[model samples]
Target: MYKSKIKNQKLKNNTYTIAVIGSHSALDVCRGAKDEGFKTLVIVEEGRDKTYADYFKSRGPSTSSGPTGCVDEVLYVDKFKDVLSVKIQNELKKRNCIFIPHRSFEVYVADYDAIEKDFKIPIFGNKFLLRSEERTEKVNQYDILKKAGIKYPKIFKLPKDIDRLVIVKVPEKARSFERAFFIADSHNSYKHESETLIKEGKITKRDLEICGKARGVWTKYMAQKRVFDTGLLSPTEQAELCQVVKNKVPDLEDLIQEYVDKYLY
Candidate 1:
């Protein structure tokens, strides 16, 4: 069984130790630990792109096989479960190591809780608080926008909403041309050759040709109205943007505040 040490409790040995698992984006953490004179161990998957390894090697740290003139050592663990095994846990315990899982792996509340319970190591960030705070902030921001009467385009989810002159947007995998569409309001509309709209009889071969002629995948079905682009960023723009973002994505601000509170302040 693992024992819990209170916050600020020094390690048995004056030396600090840290094990970072799946550390893709948390390279800074490893670097920081090393700078702090901690015996740092990083475990990454072998099949992954070797950018991380190359980075560490170039920096003259260590290799996965063992220590190589770096701060400590690097280990290439093939599986996630291997890090939690008895052998690995025993080794970590022998060194009184703290385990910090990589943030890019979609960490869950249960994962942090389990690590704290099983390994008796402190994982930065409260799982439940962070998740809840982010969700609440987003919802609140959406509500604020609605209340402030900011006009946004109606979100269409169905193909039937695609009239002769209608815009089609693919939000998830949207790119340059895919980001938005301004369909011309025409009585005789030509349909584009999109698999989604093609099956719905919304587009035809002629439409495909026209769309192909255009720079992007979305083609205007009808002659569009003259729309002025009022794209100026003013003081009001900045304030409104900040308010909207704070209301909708409060968690982002919260995270910044958390970091300041923890490290800076």
Candidate 2:
């Protein structure tokens, strides 16, 4: 049986207390709380490095590894609610402490809220509201683009909608060019590159899949064609040609107008 803080006079047995769950980033919050004279503990998934424990102890309270590190005491438990068992709850009650879960693991929100209500301890931050705001922001970006009439490539919900030569991607993974491909042209080029690399045994099929998955969304080459040139190029002749094309392509103005509306609104 682990003794509660009530037995420790230095703690005053009435100090503010918190438990951070899931992420290493919570160490910052734990250190801040300790500076404010709060009893802080951190919980993480098991088998994680104990570096945070050493860091937190050096700053404030003595640290121990529970799952992730940065804890005052370590306990190996899988579920967050396991910390609310009779033994643990009794320890908490004796210490006059509250438990606060980290915001990064949105999965624990409901459990944290339930524990807060049951134990009459405050759970810091509105996880539900924050998640709602994040979801709304993602949907609103698409809505704004649509309202401004920006020409986004068509989105496909099903694999069947993808052409045999088309590319498929996950939206969150679509940030970098290294993850992207040119579809038929890109895939064929990749196959050639892969064969050369395979002879050297440098890259694997798994690597290629990971690269493709990271790209998340794909666009056809035809979809990326520019209708007009900006005409600001140097060397006189090229600039003159670009200006002539710009004059002829009225649709270019409409595209720029759409971008201004979407971004500058």
Candidate 3:
């Protein structure tokens, strides 16, 4: 129904604006939108509006004076969640804005149901995909990857199955969003690392047991590829992997092109 509304209404002055929350990937999103000739609007928290509304605010279209910053408009809200308010949504609708969700949107809005059902704006990407990041969700990224037949890291069902170099991933004791890892190659090594972490108060014993126990992956293969084990992802390897997937799954290539043609034009 919301999509129908977007399809039926003519944009004001035939102008479309790209809107995004003012954190995480906001600068990148706004910059890309402005480069593509779309007006950019950022919804920022009151204290944080300075970056978008002041520093990167657009001076006007590009000119001989050199390039202006990307952001065109900034809407200040008391809190990020205020963006879901009907008043805010209506204001965005008046400007013919299509929201582009990012990390901040999922982290601050934090409610998948509200984002999918209550927020009545046209979103440029799949909002439902946001919930899949939560491992506690009934169906998550791992499940989706498995169904798509995408090759991901192998999961050990038990600690005893860990026989090669492996990393136990767990959330930091204070910062849940950030991951803390300890490498181990066997049951003894796993126990030793986990105990060290617990003794250092870097992670809770419960979290180490529940989250790290069966999540260890044989990461020597990744190290051999000079990837994740090095604590960095190789862009070259990433591109090659993508190409391999596209060649192996012809339907996925078509699906990606379809999305690009429909949403990106």
Candidate 4:
């Protein structure tokens, strides 16, 4: 119940109130909300940032718990679910706030009924947020991509070409599998390790068989080809990209536009 900003300010029933969780991740929604005359409330667990929260001490002393620019008030909570509880949101008492979550906290966005039931705060989000959060539940994304006519690298065969430095990788869907994290440069190393793990009883024959089947991710995309990727990703660009996508604007599509409109030539 941090009330420094709200102490004297008139709490409006008509003006929209936006509650942001990942201020570093989805700052656009905060700025946009403020621009549209919506009161912004940023919620921080330990006063962290929006994206990864690795080293996000981005806030100044004036706000401390919250960042400036788009934020009106900053609220800190000991627990995540507590903020969603009616007992906690009742601390806001009369102010009407819409909980529009950023992508970093999109998991909570999927819990629409529970959040709405407890906080009675309407989110200005849609089913797309839920879909984004449920990406882990989907293991058939490659099949879906194939259906979309998107091309992928060629699959490998056993006793395949090892001299060419064939790539062995885990499928995107099955990347969570404990043993699938490795990426071997050549077929020989991959085969040797798989067999070694099976022999050591660390992986069973059935597990090996299943892994082999799913190991179609081993592709011949860069077979003997020296590839040079240009402008792949930079820290500043990626950071800007992360900040821009959380709201509805979507990807560098919106950010690039913002840059051109505001700063670029």
- Compared with the true structure, what per-residue lDDT tens digits does model 2 show for residues 193-216? 455654655545554555444322
Q: Count clashing residue pairs in model 3.
A: 0
Alpha-carbon deviation at 171 in model 2, angstroms: 7.5
The CA lDDT of each predicted structure is 0.45, 0.46, 0.74, 0.51
Query: Candidate 4 — worst ten consecutive residues by lDDT sum?
Result: 241-250
Winner on lDDT between 1 and 2 is 2
Model 4 bad stretches (over 4 Å): 1-14, 22-26, 46-68, 91-93, 106-119, 127-132, 138-265
lDDT of each residue in 178-264, candidate 1, tens digit only:
222324333233233255455654444444444343322332233222332222254335421211111211233454575688689
Residue by residue across 1-265, what tens digits does model 3's lDDT show?
A: 9766544543431399899999977887787676556788999887888999899988954556766899989988889999999999998999899998977788888889999999989997578888888665767788898899998777776677788766567778987666676566797878887888889989888766666333232233233221221122343344222111112112334445756886897
Candidate 3, after superposition: displacement of residue 2 in Å?
A: 33
In order, how many clashes per candidate? 5, 4, 0, 2
* Candidate 2 accuracy as TM-score: 0.37
Residue 165, candidate 3: C-alpha displacement in angstroms: 1.6
Q: Which runs of model 1 end up more than 4 angstroms from their true locations? A: 1-14, 49-54, 58-71, 105-119, 125-265
lDDT of 2: 0.46
Order by TM-score, highest first: 3, 4, 1, 2
Error of 2 at 175 (Å): 17
Q: Which stretches of candidate 2 lie over 4 Å from their true place?
A: 1-14, 22-24, 52-55, 58-71, 81-91, 108-120, 127-265
Model 3 Cα shift for residue 88 (angstroms) = 1.6
Error of 1 at 192 (Å): 15
